[model samples]
Target: MTVVVNHHGVSAADVLTVARESATVSLSVDAIAAMTKSRSIVDSIERDGRPVYGISTGFGALANTFISPERRAELQHALIRSHAAGIGAPMPREVVRAMILLRIRSLALAHSGVRHIIVQALVDLLNHDITPWVPEHGSLGASGDLAPLAHCALVLMGEGWVLGKDGHRINGGDALMAAGLTPIELSSKEGLALINGTDGMLGMLILANDDLAHLCTMADVTAALSIEAMLGTDRPFHPSIHAIRPHPGQGLSAANIFRLLQNSAIMDSHRDDFEHAVQDAYSMRCAPQVAGAARDTLDFARGVAARELVSVADNPVVLPDGRVESTGNFHGAPLGFAADFLAIAACEIGSISERRVDRLLDVTRSRSLPPFLTPDAGVNSGLMIAQYTAAGIVAENRRLASPASVDTIPTSGMQEDHVSMGWAAAVKLRRVLDNLTSLLAVELLAAVRGLQLRAPLQPSPAGRIATEFVSLFAGRPGPDVFLAPILEHARATISGRDLRQALEAEVGPLA
Candidate 1:
């Protein structure tokens, strides 16, 4: 698949294809024409010898310093090399790819005053599967993700490190040579244009938004299974119950649970029994409310990402009338807030899931099920420590939930005072979502075992299919064995999407 880059902006799906699927990228003829037109204005400005913030002068606190025309190329080169100061481990290939794609998208909009070949060079990197080695730090999220993007721009100059298509790290110049490509020299305004944007944070946001949406449905599925395993009522999931208040996410989640539990013999068997509690505990009864709010929050984040997708996060944007004006579009407060908000939402989902896993383990709380769902009782520890693992992750997620956007520190000689810290928020949000995936996997493991303990009483059709799918990786439920590998397999199942796909096949699409 080839994603055509245009000034009209790309969709989140298009970004994912280029980022994850290794889909090649191409610049539209119109995008190239737009770049040519914008570059002329920059050239004209350079010849007139008027000091432009990015064209003829140094950046940030150094903006006051002016450079002669002969030295402008060196200035752009120095900007990329010096700004390439990110620290810590290299970012994943997909993230670097997404950042490159988004940067191209921004430049292709013709507001960044970069040449068409600059956009084409980035396109070549993506097409050839040459991913730059971008370290995870060095952006205040106010002056854009400068350090990270600079690392990427360094690759365009053939002077950084990159992972080749074969997944081996190589010198940037060597990688370019191997791909039969030539590096371009940075020109006036081009280096600043490359590094100045919120592409890194925005890319992470779009990826997390997609992952969390899928997890929301997966949460509903697991919540239903947990309800059946615990002998809880499904009354709370009724469509009418959610209709009165009617948040869109709430209705969708309730409908999913309601359908997942339909034709469930376990639920039907308990319907008439007065012994069964009239109501379930909060974890089971209020599953939709917690998961629903997370879904709603994800929707809000998606909206923010959508708006940012088309925005020009650059300084000194070139106008249609050929005016280059500095603007605050590079600020990352919006992306930072969205990423932080999502961390809280994802953390809450894991928090409630931990509660459900706890209930399935405790003898006093799990009703008729064996302690920790182990038939041998004290002879086998069962899933006791599994609950402990979930608890640890939940605690960690709670700490990660603290908003990174609220904190700020000055950078660039205090010229960039009151930093957004959005890059920090984005990085932490990735951790929270990953933890949520593990947390959900743990819940699925316990709930599947609990359902098996229910035995002769059949689960809902969807639940039975889920049990079978997890069983392939986890093996038949029995006395405790070497559990780490089993748990890893179960995590793979949740992350792999096979379980959800199988259930949806049985019950149709979830919300």
Candidate 2:
């Protein structure tokens, strides 16, 4: 798919396509016209010789200093070079790609006063698969991810490094040359325009939002399976029970669980049995409440990402009314708060999932299923350690849940104080999501085995389908034989979209 960049109307879905799917992008004709108009305004201002924040003067703490016309080009170069002081390992290729795409989106708005050719250079790099080597550290998430973005801008000047299609590192100048592209010379405020934006943290936010939405659905699927495996009733998921609360996410999660348990033989087998407990544990019965809250939090985060998609996050924005003004749109507070909130939500989901796994593994609590879901309880360890793994990941997620947005440090000689630390929040949120995937995989593994141990008492149609699909990778449940490979395969299946897509095909769509 080819995404057309314009002054407005870009969506998070569009960013995902270009960032993760390697979709090429082009500037719209309207975007070009806007760029020309904004560029002329920049030129007129420069001609009047008034000191602008980034055009005729230095940046950050040096904003008060003025430069000669002949030295302005050097000033731009120095800004990129000095700010390229990020210290850490290179960021992932997908992250770099998303940052580049988003930066293009910001510049395409024509508010940053850069020439259309500079935006085209970025697009060319993306189309040619030339990814800049942005480091993992150095972004304060204030003033628009300066250090990391500088590395990206350095590549435009053919002065940094890039990763080739084959994943090998190549010199930036050589990479551009091989792609039949020319290196751009930074002019006036062009360098600042290239780096000053919330693209880095915003890119991660968009990607994480996509992943968490899918995982939220998966949480519903796994929770339903666990309920059936433990002989729990689905009555709590009744529509009437949730209608009183009326939280949108709670109702959605309850509906998903209720629908998944439809025609469930396992649930039906004990529906009238006198020995069955009147109420199931919170993990099984209250699954919707916990998972529902996570969904609500994700919905909030999604709104933040949507708003940022069209916002211009630059210091000195060029207005359509021919006036240049400084703005705080570059601050990362919104992105930071969203990322941190998502992390907290993810932790709760994982926490509830781990509890379900614990229930499935406990013989005393597993409702007569063999200890740890194994036939020979004493002879085989069974899934005893799988619960341990889930617990470990859940603990790690709790730690990763610490909000990075609340922490701050002054920088640039105290000229820039109270940073957002949003980049750190995004990075840790990624870790939290990954940990959630692994723990959920553990829950899925345990739930499927518990369902199999239920024997002739079959699961719901949806559970059976999920069981059949997982069996392909998890192999038949049995004695503890080489478990790592099986667990890893289960993780891969859960983490990717395959399991959810496969389930949706049979059960219709999950919320």
Candidate 3:
């Protein structure tokens, strides 16, 4: 199905499909008309002889310089050439695609004063799968994502590198011609319009939201598995027990645990036993509250992304009243804060899961389970170092959670003195999500083994689904096999939703 950029907004679901699932994209008719109308205003301004910030005049530190109409197009091209200064490894292909897609969506607002043809060229680029080689670094995220967006604009001018559908890097000019697309000659304000906005950081923020959403649900599922594996009771998850505090997430999590334990001989075995611990640890007991907080944060981030999708975050915005004026709508502080908050949330979710992993591995803590969940604790170290791996990843997540928005260095002769380091925040959040995926995998790996040792005693039906899913990678646990493959498979199963679906099909959907 095609995702339409109606110039009103795009949904987070639409962004994920186009960015990662190769979904088709198109512009709306009204958006095309708006661009044409805005383009006329720019042309009128050029004739009126006023030194518009990006039309008849220069950019950033050179904002005071005026350009003759004859030289205006050259000014635009030169601006793009000088600003495409990003340095580092190429950004992931999906991210580059998102950057292009979002840039087009913003331009569709017609506030950037870009010609409809330029917007169409960008659409054609995406339609033909001509991904620009935007660098991983080089965006302050205020004054728009200037450097990275400039790199993209450079390709439209047929002056940079692009990755073709065949996965080979080729000259941008050649790639454009190969795809039957032509280079664009930027008119007054087009270059600034192209480079100025928070598209890059916003793109990453949307994708991270998608990842963290599913990961939060899996966090609950895995925690439930761990509870049954250790022979812990699910009584603390009772609605009556959680209703006093009444956090929506807590109640939802408690309900989830109660439902997931359906028809379980293991939980049932403990139902009558007065000997079980009076309560589960905070990680198991409060799983929903922590994961729920992340859910609340995701809701906020999605709201921000939705607004960004429709809002005209351009410099020198074109208005329907026949006026074009420079504005500060390009700042990315909102996206920056969202990215940083989600990073912290992901880190905490992983941090708590790592603690659970350690608990399952410790004989003293694991109660009846064998040490490290290994059959012979002495002969096999089993998952001892696996917990270390999880701990190390959790440590890295703590570092990634450091807010990138708090720090800034001035650029453009102090013209852009207080920039948002939102690109940095977005990138770090992606890493935190990846690490969380791995951390959860390690905990599930240990939990699966713990359940195996419980044998003749069965886990809840929901837990059996989890164990069954992991069993595809982790069979009956004995001594450690090649551990990396198991971990990889486990991470994939969780990230890919196979683990969640396996359980949900039986116990119904989780919160």
Candidate 4:
């Protein structure tokens, strides 16, 4: 099925399909007509001898300089070639696809004044699986994502390189020619229109932000299961307890934990066990406060990113009344701040999970579970090393959690005085994800080990399903056996599985 770009409204789910799943893309017919009409106004303005930024004159620090009509096309081509200076390792193919889809959506708004054929060529490239080789670095995300997107514009002119379906780099001109596609000659304002937008940073932020939302929900569910396995108290998540100070996230988290352990016979049986006290440690008791704050932070970031998705975010917007106006919409501070918030949220997930893992390894804190949860503690240091790994990852996450938005460096000889460093924000989001995934994996493995010792008294219905999922790859792990496979299985369990769907299938929609 063809995914339509409606310009005014685009969903996070659609971005996922086009970016990660290679969904086909096309522009709405009305949007195409709108772009044509907008470009006609731009033409009329140019024909009337009116001055406009990046149209009749130069750009950035050189904005005051005028361009002769004879050098117009050469100027457009030169802008792309000279700005295609992105360096470092290539971005993943999925990110490149996302950049293409987002740019097409922005142009479809008709305010960028790009020609219809330029947008059509981008659509054709998406349809034919001809993705440009965009590097991951070199974008300060102010004055737009200039360098990386210039590489995207380079592919439109068939000037740079692209990866074919066969996974080999070939000249973009040859690749387009082989596929019966002609190179596009960029018109006035078309080169700047294509590259001067926040699509690249927005694409990465949207996907990463969505994933972090899911991770927050999953973190709560997984933490509940870990609490049960470790024989911790349920009083901390009680409705009355949360209702008193009711932060929305804290209340929602309390409800989630209560629901996750609703049908547990073990928890019911332990209510009167005075040895297990009314209160557990902070890691178990404060799960709601810690995880909920992360959830609230993600909610804020999602709102910021969604607003950015529909914004024009281009330099020199073309007006409907035949005028060009240079503006600062291309600056990426909004996206940069949102991405930094998401990175901090993800790091907190790892931080809290590391605490739980530490508790599980401590014999005194772990209730009645064996040391390191191993049958033969002396000979097999089972899961002893796992705690060390969790600590290391938590340290790395702390380093990554340092906000990229707080830092800025000037570019373009101080003309582009303040940069967003948003590419750093985007790249750091990926690192935070990796650290959180590994941290959660370690927590799940340790939780399952703790649960095995509590047999005969089963876990709650939600916990039962999670226990069964882990049991598929690891069954009450004994001493002197390889633990690598079990750790990998635990990673798969939490990495991309739809935890909310799994919960809904067992219990109803979370209230």
Q: In terms of TM-score, which candidate is strongest?
A: 1
Candidate 1 lDDT trough over 10 residues, lowest sum = 161-170
Could you tally the backbone clashes for each prediction?
A: 0, 0, 1, 0
Deviating ranges (above 4 Å) for candidate 2: 165-168, 274-277
lDDT of 3 by residue, 1-511 (tens): 7888876757778778889988888889988888898899888898889778888888888889888989999998998998888888788888888888899888987888888888888888888888888887889886979999998999999989887656666899998898888999988888888989999999999999889988888888788888888777877777788788876766776787778866778777777677665777887777878887888888889899988888889988989898888888898899999999999999999999998889898888887788888988898889999998999999999999999999899988999899889999999999999999999899888888888888888887777777888887789878768899999999998799766777778888887
TM-score to true structure, per model: 0.98, 0.98, 0.97, 0.95
- The better candidate by TM-score, 1 or 4, is 1
Q: Which TM-score value belongs to model 1?
A: 0.98
Report RMSD for candidate 3: 1.4
Error of 2 at 262 (Å): 1.5
lDDT of 4: 0.82
How would you encode candidate 2's per-residue C-alpha lDDT over 142-239 as one tens digit per residue?
A: 89899889999999999888876676668999988998999999889999998999999999999999989988888998999999899998889999
Q: Give the clashing residue pairs of candidate 3, or none.
A: 144-197
After superposition on all C-alphas, the RMSD of every candidate to the true structure, in Å, is: 1.1, 1.2, 1.4, 1.8
**Candidate 3 TM-score over all chains jointly:** 0.97
Instruction: List candidate 3 segments past 4 Å from native.
Output: 164-168, 275-277
